[model samples]
Target: MKLRILITLSIMVLAFGIVSADFSLKWFYPEASNSTSSSDTFSIVNYDRMLYGATAGIYNLPDVNSVGSDPDDYLEIVLGSDELKNVEDTTDSSQGVWRCLDAEGNLEWAVGTGTDESRSSVAILDFYGSDGLPDIVSGTTSGWNVEAMDRFGNFLWTFPSPPHISGPYAWHSSPAVADIVPDISGLELAIGCNAGYDSTDNHWGMYCLQADPSDGMDDGITYSGWSDYPTAPGGTDGTDWDTIWFHPTDAPVISAPCLVDMNNDGILNVVFGTGWQGGIGGSLGQPGGKIICLNGEDGSLLWEYSTGGSYPAVSASLAAGDIDGDDDNEAVVGAYDGNMYFIDGDEDGDGTISGSEIAIYYHSGRVYSSPAIADVDGDGDYEVISGIGGGHLKCFHYEPSAATVTLEWYVDLGDSIISSAAIAGDPDDATPWLFFRGNVERTAFYSHTGDVLQIFISAMRGDNAYLYQVRGDGTVMDSVRIGEASYASPVVADIDGDCLLDLVITGANASYDSLFMIDFPGPDTIWCFGTDISIHGCETTEFHPQISNVYTEGCSLVYATVCVFDDDSNYVRGLDISNFGFLEDGTPIVPPNLEMINECPPETAKVDVVLLFDFSTSMDDEVGLMYTHVPEFISALRDVNYRIGIMVFNGCPTEIDGICNMVKTHF
Candidate 1:
């Protein structure tokens, strides 16, 4: 996951910086998966994964809203299968209500409203109402419904709902928000809905709706409008929209739309795929689906490429980056056809893609995970990494000079992989590692560059789990048994302020659902809390609990931030001082501080050096003697920002390059 810095809450003390030590359990939104992230801020939003329709919750960061004030409070937007339910303020049970759009695109009472078989698709936007806070937009899979609400979960407006389709789960695609219109101030919501398989209207494709409809506090959804696929000529919704590009076989877009400036022309384009044929509960065995690129501004088709196989080419979301450092970015994605492709955005600089613009590498297994880009090998270029269903972690190298894309290395675990690889640690350091779950048996770990064989497999057998640490040279460092099975990717970070990256994994088996923090260097085990199914860590700063440098005149305070998480109850507790008093290697922090007592210099000090040289007699003896000590003198002053000035003189005046150096000048 990409770390986005969005918090500005600073706790100030007397020259003492703030440091965040341990995390507390903030709150929980039931039935929500970490799969969905909030665009409104650096917070988490969850959708219902179960077939039973429920409400979507938006848990804002601490101190973001003044309404509820408590961190545990959240906004609940009710969703149902058969009817549109009312939007409720679950934060304080305040019964606050707002207006929303019904399935027919008309303003109606949103409180206690229910709809026919709904699927929660939540996204954040800041363009809806007069309030500066972010607004929420959600869509339904069965009712083809889309609604907008304020940050407080107050209903704002809804777009005209499309015809709900009942068929395989492949027809449901989550809605994505983007500012597609050049002149629009806010963003536009784009979603793909299936028009039902057994119905006469096969209207299944991407739909675009103006996100912000608030003209003022009194006026809501000034113009409720939407445009569907297959271009409805002279429809009631509006005629100003561009042509609606439908899927080739009426397949719904299951992958999230990747909005990027693929052509490097500063204009954003939408890249998505059509798949989910055959069936929903299991493998459809569908193929030959296409990944299409369309102009964001007018929804015109920019390019379309087929998967070429009989199975769905794209069931995974597309990732875009300039893997070869070309001005144009290449769209990297995986298809059910067992091939990972890198499609050139602008091959001939014509702002369009043809069939020849794609580069493919067969992974030998279906790829359901998204691709990631990183300079894993310490090279100046990026490498593509993805997890395949056949339990293979595939890494592809991009040689920018030779323009070749080939498989660098792949590790095959003996099980299936449904989760994506979490690439973490300092990329500047050559030892970054990746962690991912490999189904029923173990979670595999690998070196970042793909050259080493250090395999740390966290294996789980029923209620018993074992954590193994193997070195690159095939040496098993340690194998400790942990209690539960975990399906989520482990997060690697310097969690305990020990300056060593630790692995934080969440247990996912039936008996256990707690988080485990494993120390890196010694593999020291630290068990804090349990029973929470999910957790997320943020880089935060707090004032150091102890260890202050006291100068004669003042004290120099140091503050450092690391990764921390709250317990399941939303309670944040401070760890004992002993837990953070030692380094990862068990080195005492006190000893290092005592040895470096005089390391800090005065804050307001400056240094200047003057060099006197004579060139009148070409005195080689004196010059050589000065030269011998020059290195030592410069080294002594290197610790400080010092300036060295030289004074040169020969006969009457030294003239060089049409200028006379008669006085000291700093260089």
Candidate 2:
């Protein structure tokens, strides 16, 4: 059948420290897959399959761990069906959302959001039905429409049966779900809607509805709140968004709603900002937006605070922390008017908060980046961090003595900041790292090389420098205190011919020489021991033999050309391949029929031969047989420097291999 199979081979020289995959694999990216990785970060799902969104349909990069992978498996399955039953929309304009079911690029299902949906990120939640599968929910940009579908692509429900198509509506605000009623059973979805440009405009505000009906019979969403719009405002005559109470906003709410217990009550509360296009309302400037906190149970306003200025629409999100010395959480948000506002949730014990309750820090340009209130320096007190449109990220804290906010530090990032900063683990226990020219890159900034996972850093202690190896598992495995302080990290390579990586750390605060080169045996799993490896009586460290060519003889017998090399990749001359191995399909081909056609054996190798045979008169037939083989035996040693002598005994000898012993003693 002539079976064609994928081949895998590896060569492991455990003693001399050389390990490599013997076969080859080439990597390639399909040009027709997608243009960019989309504005949002690429998403990974279903066992390392990466779904990259674009203006066209989604491209799934299957098996992220392999090279030369084929990513076009599902591309053909999609764009050919009208329903896009498993992958993409037939109409290219309605690209839709897709789910990669496995690493083979098979699809679970795809649902089109219609043309020009401008949908926000989809959330996978288990709030749909008793089917025991996740329900996918997504809202269109601006208050258009929102859909919740089960894992099988079956539509569960759509809000506002007659959905609003387009206007100044849903931006990038995602749907947030939380346990709204402390006494109730199920959860609720809190959506912050987009208000109009003018202050008097209505119809857009906050809506809270039961995500999954507790009755189990109801197949759609029903509002839950203190108000009775279903039985009071009209008496059982209402629509989808009418069951819950509504609170109107002055401008569009572009940020996703954040739900938490604002005042430590048992119930959840929604906190979000209201804004639109940042600073684009030039001559007739746009109305400013406000940051509001609403009771999650009833849609009642807990507290609403407006930013100072002709408040430009603040598209930035909101964050909460204890800004003041008082441990009550305050709303920290950035507005488009170039400021970070810290609004106290409950100040002055009054029903409404008006003056001295809000504090502002001028950040210079439009602040679209949300403020994060965290103890970023691990100093017991919390600091407010945010960035502005002019590319400056600043940190500030409240001072009771000065009765105002004070700036701690700021750095220019060389670009406008829109994304929020994330912190992991304890701030005091963080290890420092030099960014790939300030940040980790996909399209690398420079072609310089090392290993990104293996970090080498040097520290200055007293008058000495300590070189340390920081492993990927966040542990310091090895350390050495050099004689001088080094301002740089340790650089490693095979600096000598010993096949071990050597370190070169340049000194900065010098008490000694500027440069010190040392053998770096720290954290390296492979180490070459001793001066030279003579396992097969060959200088392997100085002359390691590797298979250079492989072929077959008579279509059955396999052959390989082995060559010896030094550290400089130059051919080590005058060496013969006495022993070598070829790994085929991870198994060595034993007893290869090797023919050393091109070899230069040592010239000084000497050979001496002594022949013993019977020359008795009773063995004339045997003596005549020896005369025929003597010429052929001498011809076989033509390539050898040898001296031959024959000893004919009068009778037969005793043992088979006694010729060498008798010649060494009596002869």
| Overall lDDT per candidate, in order of appearance | 0.41, 0.41
Per-residue lDDT of model 1, residues 318-403, tens digit only: 76666665666777778877888778765575655554676777656666666666554444456676666575666777553344
Residue pairs with clashing backbones, model 2: 141-170, 142-169, 142-170, 142-171, 143-169, 143-170, 195-252, 288-311
Off by over 4 Å in 2: 1-87, 92-109, 130-133, 151-154, 162-168, 195-201, 214-243, 278-286, 322-327, 354-356, 398-404, 425-667
Sequence-dependent TM-score of model 2: 0.46
Candidate 1, residue 364: CA error in Å?
Answer: 2.3
Q: What's the TM-score of every candidate structure?
A: 0.51, 0.46
Tens digits of per-residue lDDT, candidate 2, 28-100, equal 1111111123462221110100000111111222232132233433211111111111124444333233332
Best by the TM-score measure: 1
Clash counts for the predictions, in order: 41, 8
Per-residue lDDT, model 1, residue 23, is 29
Give, for candidate 1, the lowest lDDT window spanning 10 residues. Answer: 434-443
